[model samples]
Target: MCNHLAFWFGKDPARMDAMFRRSGLMREKWERDDYRAATIGKAIEGTPNVYDPNFGRRVGIRFGTNPGPGPGVTSGFSPPRSWDDPTRLAEDYLSGRCVRVVIDKCYLYRVDSDKPERNDCWEPVSDAWMQSDMWQLCVAAALQEWERKEAKRVADNEKAAQDAEENGEEAKQKKPEVVPPVFPAMVNSALLDTKSQSRLFDDTKLGTWIDGDPNAPHPVRVGNGLLDLKTRELKKHSPAWFSTTKIPAIYDPKEPYPVKVLDLLKYVFDGDDTRISVFQECLGACLSSKLIWKHFTAFEGDGDSGKSTLLNLILLFLGERNCSTISLKKLTTEKFAAFDMYGKAANLSADEAYFESADEGRLRELTGGDWVYWEEKFKSGFKGRNITKIFFSCNRMPKFSDKSNAIWNRLILFPCENVIPADKKDPIYMTPEFWEGSQSGLLNFALDGLDRYLSNRRITFSPKIVLAGERHRSASDSARMYLQDNFVEKDHARVATHLIYADYLDWLAVNGYKGQLESNMFGKEIPQLFKSAKSQTRDGVRCWIGITQTTSKEDLDFRRNIHPTNKERARQRENDSRGHTSYGQAYARLVEGNN
Candidate 1:
């Protein structure tokens, strides 16, 4: 805005445009040179030009004054600059000297000046030296309105004359000739000089870019200057023109930023540096445009252990605008939930209501960078690759039924087992004041973690954290947990097959594990649990080898005389659902018939 204003307030607009354009060319040269700082600091004709000057004087100052340190104060202090300075455009701004003038949008564009299409040109009386031309525009508009009224009046009178002639009566009035409005005459060049600006740009290049191609069918023109993603040194560019979301926080790697915010990671991960290391990598991954690590982090276990704090901190890091809070369950169940994933850097699902969710391949597709369809309400749907990183913070471990590593491998867990006691808990950590000056330091910390992880190109967790992650994953698989609790892998250990089944039923009954009735599920899921375990018949009794159950409970024969065959049980279920005879009575009738 200042640049455009400065160029507009120039005494000779053409000379100012030429000078600024020259400055732009010099800037391009400086960027390509090895010593940009040295070249810019030097002068061109006694003018130090290596600066982004204000009021068309972005160049270095010729004469300046500085007040030396007063007794104890450090130097670098100066009184307010006087208006006599060559660059002082303060008067023009504060006094409203050029408030009524309309500057061309083309002059406002400050990047990639070589492209004529990028310039926003004057078109259809728009960006006219508007204030001065306002009166003439009003007069022309009024004249056009009068012409329209005259045309309508003549048409009505002519119709009446036609009707009278048809009736064989002489017409009372002659046909009135409608005179059309002519274009407004040009003004004198002597009074207002704008001819030079007309020749500054090619007439054919008008409305080629910012205003779009005038001849095309529905030409699209971008309005706001957006952050240029390619070369934004922390996104401080003047005219980006496309991106909507930007990191409001600046990233400076060399600055000394002290942040205690990362202490939340230590507390949540039980102060385990290895798990914290994996966590730091995850933090850094959130900063990227696309999924870098390609995994969702699950921060599980006890409340009041800083998981929420860590979540808020990450939310702060990736601004609330850049991160989406839609749950993973919604991706499969809700209408158009996938659309929320677009344009977001990370998807943070923190609600525990759907924490234990059943993923139906959509979660894998979303985090795996697969191009998926996004449906927007009342708008044409489009396909975009999912770049959003996913994170789930829940008290309960997530439930997934994928038998493969598709879902399990993509989940990394950070255990929040260490609870902050009532007395030791500090409310200050949760307050806004605690987060100040933390973004820069947190960014640096994440960068360090990123560097370490990229060395191997994969996140490495210590054996303990790896075990904890697997344990958390097994929370949904009762069979896996049952195996872990009652059995141990051994070279030659053996147990009667019936005995193992009998013990599984007792364990289920005693533990009161929900949704689990210990009959057919054990037979089906047990065999799939281990690799080498197999069945063998020893002296007429079948036995399972290579595994042993660690229990002292006496095994009751699961296959008793009352026990029905698998086929009979399945038929009984179907019959019950169809309102047939009771299964016990039906079994008795079959036995009596055999007798």
Candidate 2:
């Protein structure tokens, strides 16, 4: 595989994989040993660019591996603000609470390195000169802090003496000079603490939006920055609010679509414009804060299909900074899974299988943009909300235990139908360097979708996509699909429980579904799907009321005869609420697969 990935990425396999690492592509370890060297992007020595929490922006930040203003030029701050005096910056640094520090390299690599055994390690440094300089810097910080305190004490004493003399009383006793602790202890006390109220940045300090506050107002992030949803433009700067991270996607109208990405997407969607548009809009939506209209996306297909290609492209489009990976099982069961997405713009699972959700409520909380209570090891619980778009793909849709329309309502399913043969699968799509050239174009492609979504405020799924989605979602809960396929509503009806359960098992097995609920749970949840349905006893046998069971092969045969014409597909989209339920009568004409 590495031998063939030579299309414009050059012959260096490690460099190709290094680009993949920087672009956030996850790969298995079955490849050549050179692939392991991908982390060289991390191991390579590089200075970190300077970051100022005080300004919440990069100042003279020369990012990447190149050197910038390292500590050698530590006379004053790197970029002097018009209103900020460089002398004041120097004074604050001397006093050891200037709130300015080398958060990143003087000029650097991202600070995502593995933590050392201890912060103050001597193993990485053995040279006398460097060690002496480090010790001198720490001592200087402490001495400056002590001198600053002594000067303040003397000034306060003078003020007290003057006030006492003005009132005709004896001067007050002077306060003692305070001892300055080590730099680490000073940090613990509140000096240079971001948690202090003096900070220039904060979370959601942009604050809530809606006056009535029906659903939580998730401040939207879009395009290049936090979006002013009303104005449909990048939000103007606000001192009260700061987004900890920005979506790296930049919208430029003049940029064309990434040729390779567009080609693959068009092929995967079968050139269906509606499905393609939904995908594009979905890509755009991931850059924003949680919007209820922004439904979680499920790419349903087998491995050979373009699911991985499209999924990787999406990861590249979102950028590594704003993305997190957590599978559905983890997000539903792991206590701290949701917290993994604290400030992320998107959460994706590379591969997920359908399972009975351990906590459907957590899934709802994540997808609904409701306030989620998150906790991590040794940390107090933090309650917060995010607009992190959720995406996952599966070859075979999981058989879920859920029996409600809620989970079904919060999804936009894109059927990955077109399969790429093993011999024909393109290695270039997975090549990390391929995306760098396409970045601007991909950004614009996503921006086009954002414009459409901002205009209408919702994504419309095509009928074909609806049919595909319904088939997959219904496959997850076979009991419900069985109800749709082999039953109909009626005023006078009673089907024996044994008879209903017996055929349901046959249908469930025949439909390739896994697992079954006991008769009691099956009977318990039936009413949820059928509003008028009820269970009762008749002739000394358990029975269902208000709905009749029908295993008529005739309807299934008739369904096989009818094709999905343009008119039929258009009819499917005519009723948007058609997803919640399609009765057996309608199911006869619209039934998917062998049902």
Candidate 3:
């Protein structure tokens, strides 16, 4: 009889099996020794090899000086012919060497002839049989895991900083300089929500809202300021007007004015005319309905020219509660933050007096329809929240040095001449209440018109035009002046400077000039295109022709050197037939006659 022994030897059997019973292989220890190379190929087959532990080759193992067993002959340390017996095969163990095996259901190994030998017919012992390739796999996987975590940490740090900065900015905005610590007498205890104003004030009975009182004060709270709507104020001692001056209300009851005023107020606050006109006149200029219009509309003139009056009139229509007022001195970015926290506003107006203190970029953004950041906590307080409109007034137009032409173009200069003197002294009659009433009705009508018009028509805006030659500039300037004053599409320069060009026309015809006078009209008629041109040279040339505008002194010098010469003179023969005089003398006489 032969003595044969076989037992299961597994990877990290001690470590893995201790953690979980029946886990024959101590995977941690086996994997640490790179035994996967020996296991992967034979793991499913559960076979062991003598010469090649990976199980692809076969060879006999030597135990001390003992040669391995033969298949037919019996040896003392080898299993007997009973190796074919179920009981003997199930109880065998390898002699002195063993490679870790993945036990699926039974233990097996490769024989010299490539036959499978079961556990009962084999001897098992622990010995190192780890493959180098398995260690490489473990190292690569561990490295990848570590790198992923590192990358995530870096990304999180950057995001945290960004969030912190955003939060800080919002904090600054939430507390604007104008937010009051103490309540003023006229201020409403509760601040009005802009969103609700449109709904609550939707009804347009101006008299009902203010009671038609000539001296009544209706104070409404805005974001950071209080708007006072006053009726007529007695400037000095005045007796009750002789009871003889009362007039009957002549308004027709059938045609209520509420719709008109509501509509007009909508336009004063929400009309996208600037955006529309810009899109219409300029190709591809990105216009966002939600953005602030980057231009300014200035009503410049002496005090009484309706500049301030217009501002008041606009507010009357827009609703005193919907507007934000900034003193010219306090209109700073710092001040804007205070306004931002009250949330968003529908209209922002500042007196010309504050233009000097404003941050150019900030004002440009306000005018251009961009939102200001509130900068604290992670919330966006007010953005894309209102139909923002800006109004500015000055005693005179902003000097070129004080603002860019881009800013100037935003303004719709409403030139107010002293209202034909007769109209002024006839008991000038729009009491604040009266004016307010008229505005309420008229503006409502305008808003309805806007609501209807906007649904059907795309709001179009004129594009800034660029011009090319100085000779063509007057025509360009005329067109630009028209566009700047009015948001319409037609070339009004021909209409505005009609008298100036008419004079040119008369001068040309009287001089017996044969050259085309209307040739320069093309550039003059489209001064906005030149003004919109990114290049000054191009815009300057068009302005010069259209509106008496001139090229810059620098540009004039550059163009002067490149001015054309009379090449036509050289083309003609010096001795062409029929003249009774020399060509030079003939030419001189011709020039003198024209002059």
Candidate 4:
């Protein structure tokens, strides 16, 4: 027989109570030391077994190989050294050997006052031990059952809530609200309708070469007008213009994108026509043939100059067919170019507010040349290419070093000085519809004009304008041709230089100059225009005119001359009065002696 007594606690209390009620297990409690015992059986009517009831303790198993008679007594068995040893009483409790004794508290085990049965039944111990153990087991069991049921209920509620959330999301997606496409009056619904046969463009109307090489990765869609993909999902006040006018077609930087510009330049050279007729008005400036300006354009301006507003109008007029807009902050040059330009969506830069001045290095890359390279700067260094067009806005003009070769050469400067303050400008923001309509009106007009001009002419920079006037025709031609051949190459741009000697000569002619131009003649004009223009230069730079002259002022000032008639008149008057020899002979002597 086992020497230990097994005491089980944490029994189901409800079940235990039912058993107690049926079996007459409840009785008056008696105190033994710090604990209380419930009386059980007529044999132990007033014995203490249960402990202080209110202070709860974790119900678990305890094994004593030899139990003492009273509640607090351990039968000489101290706590074991290790909890895992099987032979040890401490080990048995820890190894869960005691925990596995499943107690059915609903059934009471009877212990005879004078007799003992097998291990399954309780032995006749102190009345106190029997009474207290019974009550504790019943209470613990009922609490355990309650906890289990409560956990199940909580888990079920959470699952139901999660399922409802998922269902709600599905319902929303099924009936999503659609956003109507925005368009100008000129881009009628008929153009977009299925049955309308009014063809906006056909193969012939698109010109001979609408799409480029079939094998080319990104092909141009010729017949489609610009397109704006809109949805209610987007936020308001978002910028959305693609190309702007201020940027140039070809930029010059340390590294040139000769390879990249080649393919697009081919299309421009081939005369691929492009036109913009948005909102029933042609852009005053037209863009014809994707070849001339196959690259992207950015527009930068001061705050509230309607940079984003203008771009949005362009998108609206383009009508979700030929154009799309992105704010500048999101633009990644390499990633943007790999996509299609002629698709219904035109790639655009995102909305961006400019700093007071441009970062000189970045401005150089954007406008300087077709490509820019810096060796030690940014390890991989920026190598940008084929930036065909750009529209950007800045609060102030870009700051650049006079010595920086890139930015000074590439940028085309245009100042958008509004006649009215931002607050006084037309209230285009009264309503979305009104704002959209008016902006489309202005943008379409400008784009149309640009398209027409670029399509018809190969714009060559005329240096003749540098020397404007009807009088200096021959001299102007000589100066203009020399500057072109010697300075500006066919591939390079024509810079606005007042340093042209022909311009200086024109200034002299227009101002009414005396003799033919001479080497020292620059000294005369310098005292005038140079004061202002010279201040614009940095220190240590010398200016040269490169002009030839025919005469010298020194030669005219120093040459000896004879005044024969005047001297003779004086001498004749003197002689009439004093009989003096005439001075004509003296004058003749001076001339002859000098010769």
Model 4 accuracy (lDDT, Cα): 0.30
Best by lDDT: 2
lDDT (tens digit, per residue) of candidate 3 on 297-416: 444455544445546655554444334665333434464443431222234353466232345555555555454543323333333322345556666443332123444445444333
- Per-candidate TM-score against the hidden true structure: 0.53, 0.58, 0.30, 0.26
* Model 2 C-alpha lDDT per residue in residues 7-45, reported as the tens digit of each score: 213344554453333322346762446646553333332
Error of 2 at 584 (Å): 26
Q: In model 4, which runs have C-alpha deviations exceeding 4 angstroms?
A: 1-289, 292-308, 318-388, 402-409, 419-432, 435-447, 455-595
Name the lDDT value of residue 132 in candidate 3: 25
Ranked by TM-score, top first:
2, 1, 3, 4
Return the top candidate by TM-score.
Answer: 2
**lDDT agreement with native, every candidate:** 0.52, 0.56, 0.32, 0.30
Where does candidate 2 have its weakest 10-residue lDDT segment?
A: 100-109
Q: Measured by TM-score, how close is model 3 to the native structure? A: 0.30
For each of the candidates, the C-alpha root-mean-square deviation to the true structure, in angstroms, is 21.6, 18.4, 35.1, 32.9
Residue 491 displacement in candidate 4 (angstroms):
30
User: Which of the predicted structures, 3 or 4, would earn the higher lDDT when compared with the native?
Assistant: 3
Residues 1-595 of candidate 1 have per-residue lDDT tens digits of 1233132323333333333333324445534445543332232223312123242232111111222457866577655642222122222221211111122221232222343323321122223443234223223223334445556777877887898889988667634433232232322221123322222232222112222234422111222222122232332232112222344354655745344755666666766888878878887666554334568877777778777777777777766656788876787567688776665657787745544455557778776766666676665665556657778777776577655567777778777788888898887876657787776676667666766776768897567667876786567766667777777666666666654565454455555555553455565555666666777764455656677666433332222212343345445434643547553344334324323
